[model samples]
Every structure is written in structure tokens, then in C-alpha cells.
Target: MKDDKLFTAYIKSAEHHFSGWDFSYITDTGRMQSELLPWSYGSMAATLVQNCDAFLDMGTGGGEFLSKLRPFPEVAWATEAYPPNVPIAAKRLEPLGVKVAQVEDDTTLPFDDNQFDVIINRHESYSPKEVRRIIKDGSIFLTQQVGGTDCIQINEALGVPANDEFAHWNLHFAAEELLQNGFKITYSNESYPAQRFYDIGALIYYLKAIPWQLEDFSVEKSLEKLYEIHTQIQSNGYFDVRQDRFVIKAEAI
Candidate 1:
């Protein structure tokens, strides 16, 4: 389950979602509802990141998670591949003392090795080797991934076998990669919580933002399912439509 196709498609869709908003003027005031977003890795970092001096934030989108680490860590630097998101992240984080970098080339990082005591990857599009190269020995690396079941759970109702059954991102994949690269897997866990879409239109908009659901989707038909879900939401106020996620902690050996 390489998930190459899903990644390719999803990146484009995510770009579209980010495109609609101007990051510089983001509404700075949504009280955090629960845990991180659909694919956040904060729950992983929370357990092991205490009292670190320097940190590297990989794939920092909108600077949401990077900003949270400010109080516990003295310095936090972030790298984002999406140029549109970089300035937005910088605008939000720099005000609070976090440094930001725009990663132009995919293969290399601008930092020196052994520079970060803690490294965070919420949803990385790059290779783990690149992540390994950026951190020093004894540093901690934490990631929160869209659970392996995320796609399957969504597509099962549609009677489509998950495109890459084995490809869903999860903590185990990261742990194995880290272990092979000389890191010790320390902790991992899953949180089950649903993010609701009030209407089928909203659900479609949400689906449009992620990959995999782009091709072969019948928007009108999916909207029917959305209406049913919305009806349930109207009665219950929330739906159990959640994406599973795995939080992981590993230490560079």
C-alpha cells in the first residue's frame, strides 16, 4: 500500500482548500474544539515534547500546531512545502517567536543536523529519511497520521475496496521506518472522534479537499448520503463520521 496515488491526488485537493482562504487574515479565534484537525499529530507530541529546547515542525500548515508548542519549548522553527501556507503560518507564528521556512526543494532542508531536540510531522509528504537527517541523536520525533482505516471506512459504504488497502497512513508505518533508521519507538495510541459536516454540501466540500474521493465520485449521489447524515445530525446534533488517527513517539537512537 504505497498510497502514491492518494498522495498525488490529495495534495492537489488540499491546495484548492488552502487557496480559498487568505492566511494573513485568518480568523484568529476559534476555541480549540477537541484534539487536532482531521490529520493532526499534536496528541503524539504532547506526551513526549515536554521541556524541549529547540524543535522543528515539519509540514506546518496554517501554523496551528506550531503555535501550541511555544510555551513548553523555547524555540520552534517550522517548514512548510506549500508556499501559500508559509506566509500564513509565519504571520501567525512569528508574532509569538516561532521561526518559519519555505521549503522550495523537496529533497533538502535548510537546517544543520543535530539542531532540533524535537521534530514534529503532522502530515508529511516527504520521506522519513529526510526527517531523520534533520534531527540529532537523542531527539524526539512525533507524528499523528490519518489512520490506516480512514479511507476504507469512508469508501466501504460505497462498496469500493479501499484504493490501496494497505496504504492508509498510521503510526506503525512511521514507527517501522524510524526503527529501521535507528530510532526507538516509544509510544503510540488512537483517538476516535468524529468531525461533522452540517450538510451534504459541506461534506462534499470537505471531500473535495482530500484526495482519493476526487476521481470516480458521484457528487449528486454522495449528496443523498449527505442528506441522510444531515438529517441524523439534525436530530442528534452530531454524527459519528470520524477519521481514525494514530499518535506516535519515537526517539533518535
Candidate 2:
């Protein structure tokens, strides 16, 4: 029954978002390929898999984390806020029996109380009230968030304002918020290592995809910025893109 609703939601969302042009390019362009976005997120979801079953992958973009979670064959359902995320994710998660929820509004999810054993979010934005209700006590809520100071250099190079207003790694604040709401954090891992990109074009595409970065949307401006990055990377071996991310595996009381 849950799976049925998920499919219905995904289709409805697709119908709504398909009104625009080819969104496939967002995830399927250039040498990078949108499909590979998940691996870069992290492989730490494996830790939760060994501990629980019946997973919920909120904001499961292109089902990238789902790729690493093949071992946990528990009943799995995914919720996505965007319709564009469905068709792209289906290619990776459909064969695995993962159903997609296509609801666009950001409300509490349509899950029963205490329904899932292991809840996962790879940058899925969820409300505190919603997460509190659906996740069971003793179950794990695993999140992979943008590292603090995620991509300041990229923004600076493009003359864009860089700040952590809504950018990634803001989850640490959110985690604290969840804690205040009666959750206990059992594990917290954060890393700030050098994440590299192949070339300048890839870096520019990354800028477009990453939220919270300044973008003029002007073709000429973006082109000029791209040229600058290209020259810089060509002079250097590759761009030293700083990747900051945090992992929190908390237990709901």
C-alpha cells in the first residue's frame, strides 16, 4: 500500500515538472554525468544498513545513496520533493523495489507513526515535526550533510558571495535543532578534505547544481567565469574543491 502511493506521487510530480524542457541534462550532461552525484555524497550510509532495516530515503536525488544500500533488502520507500528527481532516480532504484513519492509540497510525509527502522537523508530537507513522527524509537536517522565551508573558493572565483545561510553543512545547526526537540545524537562525523574535479567545465556545472552559491544566470557572465576557471585549472593540475560534510546517526526517543 505504501509502495502504491509512492508510485502515484512520482507520476503526478513528473506530470507537473515535465512542462519545462529537458531536465535530464541537469543530471545527465557532460563527462561527469548527473548519475554520479551520489557517490560523491559519501559511502557512510553502509553503517546504518548493518544496524537496521525498512529504510526511508528522503530527498533521494537520483537514488545515489540507494546504490550503496543494496545489501539492506528491507521494505524501502523514497520521498522526493521534486518531480524531476523521479525519472532520474528510477533508472537506479526501480529494480531494487524502491518506490518514489512525488509530492512537491513540503509537509509531513504520508507515513504511519514509527514506520521505518533506518531513515536516511542525503541532503534531503525534512521538517522537524515530520521526522519526529515517522521515525521509530531506537531506530537510526542517518544524514549526510554538506560540510561547513563547502565551496567558498568556487564562489569567490566567480565573484559570487559565499555564505552558509542555506548552503550545505548547515545540518549541524539542524542536528542541534533536532536534539532540542528530543533526539539523541549517538554518532557525529565531519570531514574537510580536498574534493577534486576533473576540469573547469565540470566545476561550473557543479556551481549550477550546488545551492546557496551566487549565480547571475547571465550567459555572458557565466561564460566569462567559466573561462577564468578553465585557465586556472589548466595552469594547475586540477581544482582543489573543498568538500565539507557531516554524518549524524541519531536515535529517536
Candidate 3:
């Protein structure tokens, strides 16, 4: 009882190319939307960047967000663990006097201890100890992370469990880890925002973009559930999911 045409279209949507951390194809088109968070991580980072002597952006995918924070300090560096994003980030950030490094291990970063005055991360993984070691005493580390329960509704609808490894990664656990690693949490906030998909295609594209959301995701495997969600959307006008997000500003002590 599958609608052949619709299934084919959803399958095709999953093939859409996603680069860096950009989701403009769906976000810009208004096909998918996530509600705004209470705090602005960008504004907070920009203020820090204005006064810092040395800055670092960890897990800077394609340097898309960092490039916008102009008027860089004398020493501005970005690191990307994903191989493909390193070149893209370099091409965009180097001309602006930002050096991009390809990093493999978060525990052992490339920089020297007490190197940066400020560090910013957006939805990137980091070792609390490494962050403390790299930043000078009294320096700041600001990060906006995707929490453990992020997009749980999507996984439930698709009949899959969320990634167990990151299931315990929430604001409380992260802040405690930072404190244990010689950081004092100065600011912290956690929120579950609503993300809506107006079409099945947008949902498929999102799943493809974030492979870790549903590790075994494949159009062939999820087609039936995708169709069910598609039908729900047809009836209800949209499919809504929850986004788990938290921001922390910790000072190295």
C-alpha cells in the first residue's frame, strides 16, 4: 500500500548534498524551521571576540559561523575534525587571517597549553580537560551543544532508539565535567526548541545531513515510516520534533 511516486521523491531528497554545517536548503526555503533559542551564542561569542588577544573556534565546520565574526584578533584559529570541512574552512577563513587546522583527536589538540584567551564551539564535541589546558587562566570557553534528547521524536516515529553513547550528555553532566576539569561555569542555559517539517522531503534531507541522529538510516529502510509521517503531514500540515540545545560559558580557573 505504498505510494510509489511519493516514496521515490523522498528517496531522491535524501541524496541532497549538505556541506559544512549549513542547512539553508531547507531552512531558507521555509520547508523546515526551528524555533529561536532564549540566548544568542553568536552575540555572546562576538562580544568575547572583540576584546580577546587570541581566539579559537573548535569544530568549525566550514568556518561558516566563525567567518561572520569579523575583526578577528591577531591570533585567530579554527579546528575541524571532519576531513572534508578542513579544506573548505581554510579556503574561506585563511584570506580573512584565520588559520584552520585539521584535528583528529579532541583529547590532544594541536595548540600549546594556555594559548587562547577565548574559545567558541557550536554543537561540537570537546574534552573538558583539553579545553581547560588550552585556554589561559581566566579565559573563557563558550559552547552551544546539542543535548542528548535532541530530535527524539524523529527517532521514535521512525521506530529507532537514540544514540546510547550520547544519551547522558545533558547540561548537568557537561557542567559538572567542566567543573571537575578546572573550569568554573559562569553562564549556562538549556532549552528544548520545537523543530517543524512542512514536508517529508525536508525531514529526509535532515536525516541524511545528520547521520548520527539515526545511524542506520537509509531511504529503503525508513521508506515505510517516512510514508507514514508523510501521510501525517498531509493531514496535520506539519510534523514537529524537539531539539535539545544547551549553552555554557565556562571560565578557566
Clashes of each: 0, 4, 0
Per-residue lDDT of candidate 3, residues 46-80 (tens digit): 99988899999999999899999999999999999
- Candidate whose TM-score is highest: 3
Q: Write the per-residue lDDT of candidate 2 for residues 76-154, one digit (tens) a residue.
A: 8887766777877776787778877766654658788888888888766667667778888877787777655776777
Go through the candidates in order and give each one's C-alpha lDDT. Answer: 0.63, 0.64, 0.93
Model 2 bad stretches (over 4 Å): 1-44, 50-53, 167-172
| Best-matching candidate per lDDT | 3
**Judged by lDDT relative to the true structure, which candidate is superior, 1 or 2?**
2
Give the Cα error of residue 9 in candidate 1, in Å: 29
Candidate 1 clashes between residue pairs 3 or more apart in a chain or in different chains: none
lDDT of 2 at 74: 59
Error of 3 at 103 (Å): 0.8
Of the two candidates 2 and 3, the one with more favorable lDDT, higher being better, is 3
Tens-digit lDDT string for candidate 1 (181-219): 878887777766755443333444455555464346655
Colliding residue pairs in candidate 3? none
User: How would the candidate models be sorted by TM-score, starting from the highest?
Assistant: 3, 2, 1
